[model samples]
Target: MHHLFMVTLKTEQSKRKQAFFWINAMAPLTSVILGSILVYMTHAEKHGVQVIGHLKKGLNPPSVSELGFGSPYLMTAIKAGATIGIISLAEGVAVGRSFAMYKNYHIDGNKEMIAFGMMNLVGSLTSCYLTTGPFSRTAVNFNAGCKTAASNIVMATAVMMTLLFLTPLFHYTPLVVLASIIIAAMLGLIDYGGIIHLWTIDKFDFFVSISAFLGVVFGSVEIGLIIAVTISMLRLLLTLSRPRTYALGNIPNSITYRSIEQYPAAANVPGMLILRIDAPIYFANTSYLRERISRWIYEEEDRLKSAGETSLHYVILDMSAVSSIDASGIHMLEEVRKNVDRRGLQLALANPGSEVMKKLDKSKMIEKIGEEWMYLTVAEAVGACNFMLHSCKSTSAALTNPAAVEPNTYDYV
Candidate 1:
């Protein structure tokens, strides 16, 4: 009925379409009320129709002393409370941010979390159980054209009025009717199109989504939430553990460097190798990164050997994307430097961020690797390495053939 009403309203040729839209939007609530009234008038309760019995009148009284802080169950309570709290917080923030994105607005996640935490604290003080922004309620609120948080205020005011003056009216509200309203609201949250889109775009994401859905349907909500969170964490760990490394090559007629795999036009520098690590340096990826760097060096050497060209000498690590480093990461870099030195090649760093510099300085790695070998940019590092390489070659040539003109060190300078 809700869908049908939307379809009709969409085609309505009326200047007061907004008024009609509001009326159409209220149809679900109206159906619940009128259905309850009809059941009450006809004495449907006599026919085994379930209705809400007497509800306690008035607002919730203070229960400041009712909170449990006892011995045997205190730890259990805390664990359970924390798990549910985190799940609720994640769901609420995800829903809120998703809607904010759809509406093209910014949502400060930290601010939202703080606001939710304060609300939960107040609720606990007043004897309320855990509450979260359920997707169904959020969808209905959005459908009802709520433009601001003021809608929440309006809803709270209505709830207070109901508690104070309209409690008796709910006595005849059938449970089945309430269930129907919930089912109607929840139908909008199915989002089959989203599932289809996910399947088309990323099968792994689709698998996660389907797994969560099946877990909830077959087991429990908590089980489903656990499965979803576990899969998400695993994905993050996998990405970090096997982070992508690229062989950077210089673009033609530009100082810019880019991945050769990504840009086929980018050309490798003669007698030099450049690599870009695309993730922060941490313990988990240090070993993998070390091995990957070695592989890149071996492949470059093989390519040079096959083509009868000069072997690699200067290995420049473009650390522009490396945001942070740990002790393990520093150790890995030391090992790499030793390996490069064993191969009679120099290791150079390009564009290390402040954090990386600080850590390296504290570990005395900067001094060990030579401060002069580090540069502000990859281009500068490559130029300096090239100049030094030419100087060496010219000195060697002068020794071999004194008649050969002196290698022009002035041109490099």
Candidate 2:
């Protein structure tokens, strides 16, 4: 009895899923089926210019070629219609995902795809190409107290009744009016405000949007989607290449060390640079990291040369922020160690995670840099390097203090 009850529950769940799928697919299937039949009929009539057409056309003339019939223009019209429909559905589903977040509802993407597929399958059989979820109609339903799929039944019933009884009434509706509706729908997709907003937020995003817009307007819609996706991926790689680095220090009355640029009152590690890498070390960004470190080394060398001094002494790499490492990164680290040693500067690594440490160990970097150079904490690393713990004097005093800071005439000039 228990097993039978559980089996029955599973069957009910499966039926509900099927029901929801049908609900989502029905509207697009019906709309496209009807629209296609109308197109086929109008083409058969081959009505060139009626009294109603002349009345609809103002003093400003419009194109009189009706493409609903079997012509070269008819194929182009159908192609354009399919393109617009697919784009509308893509944009609609994205909006639905956003609203689903606020409404605390879960959307099954695979099920939605099945529904969408069925819509196209049924629509094509009825002399249509393809149709998709209409954003405007869905939004209207959402606003008008549509709680369940039952609302669609009422809506479909009304539409069917209208089609059966009021066919003659729609004959008086001008061709120009229908054309205007199609044009309006297409125009809605050209999101000028969205483009502007993307530009304001990120210059890279602006470039991407511009590329996509131009591709769509000047080239083809298919080409535009391809260009947009490609550009997005390239932008992601570029971002990873220049991961943000910060000089971290302890905030007053707080144990947590934050970026000195963020908190002015934070205690800095004088005579020692505490640098934090804000990303995983990988082949893509290895050269970028090297360049940044090289810049700092060059600046330090120039200061030392003017003061008749030797070195900045120590650089503490705070690796607590690093979550992972790759083979290219290991090679980069070895090169950095060699370069720093050749320059008579000490390079110490602090707080490498277990995974990173294991990689470092496998790479045999710990012994090359010395086990003493590896510390669990930044403070311990600084102490091992024989750097001062606290700043007794202010930064102004340190700048003027001969013992703390060597005089560099070249820096002043």
Candidate 3:
């Protein structure tokens, strides 16, 4: 759908929307008219006649026998029809929502689902498999300035004209031509590069793409969908299992700090460590976060020891990127606090959102850690640590000032 959308139109949102509105309505109408034309052409052409003659082999319209309802072949056909309906509806909804996201609009998934389901139900009963909104058409609509539902009316009129006036022109169209057209359509749907892209960017999605493609080839369409959905859910679990959390620090020549992985030379405060988890804290990822913090602290201490420097005593979990936290995350937080306290290391928070703060409050995390420990910003935490360092230096200076009072150059040896 995305490829279709990209190929069919320019980048303008309004133009895309208008084109989508027209095409979405027109495509199906075109398909129906084309089907009728093919049916007519079958009677007129020699090859079509030959194909029809072959189709007539053992093709007796079902007799009114109770056995007809119980036939496995009939069951398979019914299942196939259901599969097509589901695919169409699911594709329609997903494509619709994706476009809505691109346009920064909100689509009610349930409402869209209802519309899709009803459309399929109607299509199925009317001798059409389930049909949903096509992404190409929707993308065109998104690019176009279609604000109303009137486009479909025009589409229906155009289809009527084609059926009434243009039917005879297509009477000699070969069966092989239609087969080629369908084969090309299927080829267009295949995304070999998309599979490779997914493999490079996300291994799990690559697995899904492969699983889905193979399932369709070797198994039933329903199996393909099931595998696709299951793979998607597993991918979510895999992501949460080891979420992308970065160790961040200040860039030397810039005001902004960056992920240490991206900029290793960035200055991290002495005796302090910054860990940035770029995901919502949930039950699925709570253990991963706990393990990450534990490993990071141990490694940081080891590195400091190797350098003959004071070990980092403060670990800041930068929650600015975190949007939400769950109960399991809260439990993990409590455990982290206890462990940090045991090691005489401080754990601090930075830029927790209001809702997250409220969750922390309800969990009694703020009270347990103390208000001074919670920092609103990374700079505030750095300033606090710097102040403590400066105060210690000032006290040392006061103690040593009188003992080393002036003119001690010759005593150095």
Which candidate number would show the highest TM-score if scored against the true structure?
1
> Which residues of candidate 2, in runs, are more than 4 Å off?
1-179, 182-200, 206-224, 249-268, 304-310, 370-372, 376-380, 383-413
* Ranked candidates (lDDT, high to low): 1, 3, 2
Q: Model 2 residue 44 lDDT?
A: 32
Q: How far is candidate 3 from the true structure (C-alpha RMSD, Å)?
A: 9.7
Candidate 1, which segments miss by more than 4 Å at Cα? 1-19, 41-49, 65-84, 124-126, 189-202, 206-226, 405-413
> If scored against the real structure, what TM-score would every candidate get?
0.83, 0.56, 0.62
Better of 1 and 2 by TM-score: 1
Best-first order by TM-score: 1, 3, 2
Please, what is the whole-model Cα lDDT of each candidate in the order they appear? 0.84, 0.66, 0.69
Lowest-sum lDDT 10-residue window in model 1: 6-15
Q: How do the residues 1-413 of candidate 3 rate in per-residue lDDT, one tens digit apiece? A: 32233323323232347544555434433543555466574555543332222221221243233334667599788888677766776776666655565457887878987877776555544444346776445543433344456866765675567656665555444444444333333444455776788889989778887897788668845567679888888877787777888788988866566788888798777888888888889998898889988988888889998998866778888899889998998999999989998988888888898989999999898999878888888878777876876787788887889565456778887
What is the clash count for each candidate, in the order shown? Answer: 0, 0, 18
Query: Lowest summed lDDT over 10 consecutive residues: which window, candidate 3?
Result: 51-60
Output the TM-score of candidate 2: 0.56
Q: Once all C-alphas are superposed, what RMSD does model 1 give against the true structure?
A: 4.7
